[model samples]
Target: MGLTDTPPPHVPSWVVPASGALLITGAISWDMCYVLMSIRSHRTKSYGMPLLALALNLSWELIYAARVAEHPLERLGFLVWLLLDVPLVYTTLKNAKHEWRHSPLVAENIGAVLTAMVALGCAANYAVADWWLSAPGTGFGDKSGKWWAGREGFDCTELAFWTAGLAQLALGTGCLAMLLVRGHSGGTSYAIWFCRALGTLTGWIGSTSLLWWYWPEAHGFFVNPMGIFLMTTCLACDTAYPFTLAVVRRSERVLSDGRLVSGISVKQSAAPIVKKRL
Candidate 1:
């Protein structure tokens, strides 16, 4: 909470007060999303977070915590996220084979795939961070953590726009695809979706917009066409997801092997529709 010895002259007094509140609210919501996903995965014996999305998330936390983030609070948050991902990742890998029945090659080699994805994710993160910090006009070392900008530069705000935006796209879109393929909400819940959707709204969209309002010159990119497209796509997917869940829930059937699948069972089938919903 210490102010910069030399603050950005253009920064308004209210920036911190407004942004900090949004940051805390978004942080709590995202943290709860992960915690709820972990509990749901264990209860239903299924994995949450699509496979590639899991790899991207785990590696993002690891790379940021270990190398990229400088602020002690930022590093601590990344570390906590990595720790929470452990059980969620483990359960997903353990139970993934059941869902991959149509693709034996993938089912047999998912662990290797995940390992490769994590390696790639780490490399991608490092490369992006290095490029962002090394660019001629952009590398100011995050002065905005305490101020606003450095010598009229972006102050690393673009990194979050790209990196965290990518994560949101992967998670929001991938989750819906997973639900469609599985035809059940075994590893997902309204709580998880609610927290995730709300977190992104408050954390990225709301707070970033507030910053834009105060500093248009450097922060205007957030409301431009490209940024608007990205944010709109994410919100659309999340909004559509819960309705999809509602439709899929009506005919949810339990398989003979104890896994939940979509569709009502036949008269001769051993599986039956599960009346209770999560």
Candidate 2:
């Protein structure tokens, strides 16, 4: 059934607006982390978000904003996200060459490569959304043989929520892995990670609660094996990220000259070595 066709899920009057506020706050918080990361990258000349994650995130926002027009508030939220992504994407591309200097070819072609990846990601997102809307049992199709072209069957709210959750999981894991491999928080701070984790948690709760209250019949999706696994894995990674950053920071060495070094050899002259003069 279309969104307008079905009355909103019955719940306490306060639930809908409260959940919406939470969702909007989560979106703002998440984008703010990217803003901070972009600023860090500008200062450090190191890219924060992994290329794959950036592509997926940008594409998700663009595709969702374009396809999900039924809900004005939610569509506006997506548009706001797209606007926030502009600076993040710019900083990422600007620092790409410096961040991946090991491969000159990639550094030179980073912009083109990322653009292509985003195009592919948009296509993939569209395909997934279409499948979710038209698929049997899960989709909005009636048993009657006639296919309605302009009519919508599935709820865009649920579709957007699940798609965004999955995308966030992927992006979060990729970012965490990149930070670990670098062994230094060059373009990301603990604050960014903390905000991201909090935002994801809040968004998850808001979106899931709304769905549960409105579409009680589909509540099983939240408790399904795959759903549980995804949620657990995302939360586990987010929770451990702070410790990972802390460990990385501790492992870093500060030279006598006040320069920080990670996984790199420091000369005795550069680092203070206490010597006994007999």
Candidate 3:
């Protein structure tokens, strides 16, 4: 079957609007979080999003946004995300020097490193998209078969959803780790954490619902051991993040100059925690 020739799956009336709401709300919340983070980074010169996360997100938006053109609403959503990412990317690249300020060598070579990261990220995203397109049940086999014609495999949508979920989970985990290590919320805030957590929850629900409705045979992927474990881990991390921030804030002191100081005195500490603009 060709990609466009596949019949649309039968879905119940309510599932469409419910899934749409989840997906749309999740996307908008995430975009707002990124925008807020970018604004904070600009003023504080401290970028919040992890480098790997930024690269992966940018690449995912670029590739999938174009590839899903047949689905007008989904394509438009991706395009909106892509547009929002531009400013965040620019802010990250522009203020990266501050992140590497302590390491002169890294600061000097940051641009080259960022360039390489973007290139590598794009390559990785392409690889995932290719894998999805070539997977067994996506109706792209007629096209994919030209290369590896007869191999048996899993569903494309399952693989793609899993890939994106894992990437988002990793991003959230990495941000949590950074906050813990720094002992202060610099470029991160409660708002970012809250939105990210809620967004991930809704996105997960939305993706799973859509897949279940469209590809009933693939529903097992959600309840399988690996899937359950991954989802649980993501939820655990995201849910705990805000409380963690609150606990850490108890030890934080706002200085006269507006810099945030963690447990240690500013005079004795080598690095003072700069307050992120709310």
Candidate 4:
């Protein structure tokens, strides 16, 4: 069983964690909406693709919330998220294709595929975790698929976890590399860089925890705690991204208007010449 299979050992005051998680989730969802609105206001109607991608992710989160309750509604919601992912991934790929036309970050585009795959694969992992959590006497060390051991159905679930974790690490690294290489005004900010670094570090280390869990030496006990820590870090990273973007935009405006040019060099401050006079 994965780390998420088990609930918190010490259930805190019922209101605190539940309310906090729900509130934070809601706020993050709102942040996505704000991102969408900002894109719409700043860019042309071409932002439809990003809005669609945002919607797809939000749908997945909705399904996730419902799934925890084991209601039939969860299945339908997840199905919708799955369907939406197809087009969303397509749009993201199309955007990357456009980006690759001018940028040499082909590897980063490939990493985008990995990101989408990992994001979607979490569903199957949750299913595995749920089954394991429901079973009895399945001690912490039990990696045996009790619910899935003898089933005639093929089990791609464990494979999903492995694939997702690897993809996540690759994507994080690819993104960091792209940021270092490209460092556009949007990309150069300390907040965005720091958040990406933290996210990548947590993801890489978390993958190691999963590796240890799969290995013969230690059991799965450490995996869950480490994974929870990593996930919370990721959630923090995602939550911070929008605010970082907002700050970047403001800074860009300041720089463009020549209102804040204290430390930059003459070359750094100079805009590129688009044409040369005859």
RMSD of 1: 7.5
Better of 1 and 3 by lDDT: 1
Q: Kindly list the per-residue Cα lDDT of model 4 for residues 1-278, writing each as its tens digit.
A: 12222222242334223332433343334334334433332332111223223433443344344433232333443454455445434444444443344555653564555466455645654665456445444334434332333332222223323333333434333433443332223213444344334433433333334334334222353356544554455445445544544443453333442222213223564767688789
Candidate lDDT scores, in order, read 0.75, 0.70, 0.65, 0.38
Please give the ranking of all candidate structures by lDDT, highest first, separated by commas.
1, 2, 3, 4
Candidate 4: residue 252 lDDT (0-100)? 35
Per-residue lDDT tens digits for candidate 3, residues 1-278, read: 01222223454555545655777788788878887887766655567887777777777677666653345566777778888877787877676675566677767776677668767877887787686665455432222211122343433445555767767867878888866765666667888888777778776655565646554553557766777777888888887788888977888755554444466454576888899999
TM-score between candidate 2 and the true structure:
0.80
Pairs that collide, model 2 = none
Model 2 lDDT at residue 148: 23
For model 4, the run of ten residues with the poorest summed lDDT: 43-52
Model with the higher lDDT, candidate 2 or 3: 2
Q: CA shift at 100, candidate 3, in angstroms?
A: 2.6
Better of 3 and 4 by lDDT: 3
lDDT of 1 by residue, 1-278 (tens): 11121335687887856765686677678889999998888777787799878888887778767755665566667777888888887877888787787899988888898899999999998888777666434632343443322333335455666677888889889999989878898888898999999999987788778777775555677877878888998999999999998988787876665567778444676788679978
User: How do the residues 1-278 of candidate 2 rate in per-residue lDDT, one tens digit apiece?
Assistant: 12233333354555546666777778778878878887877776666788888888899888877764556666777777788788888877777776676789889999999999999999999998777667434532231221123453455545655677677778779878977777777778888888788788777655566646655554446666666777787888888888888988878654454333476444567767788999
- TM-scores, each model vs. reference: 0.85, 0.80, 0.77, 0.38
Q: Candidate 3: worst 10 consecutive residues by lDDT? A: 140-149
Error of 3 at 240 (Å): 1.5
Candidates by TM-score, descending order = 1, 2, 3, 4
Clashes per model (N, Cα, C within 3 A): 0, 0, 0, 1
Q: Judge candidate 4 against the unseen true structure and give its global Cα lDDT, from 0 to 1.
A: 0.38
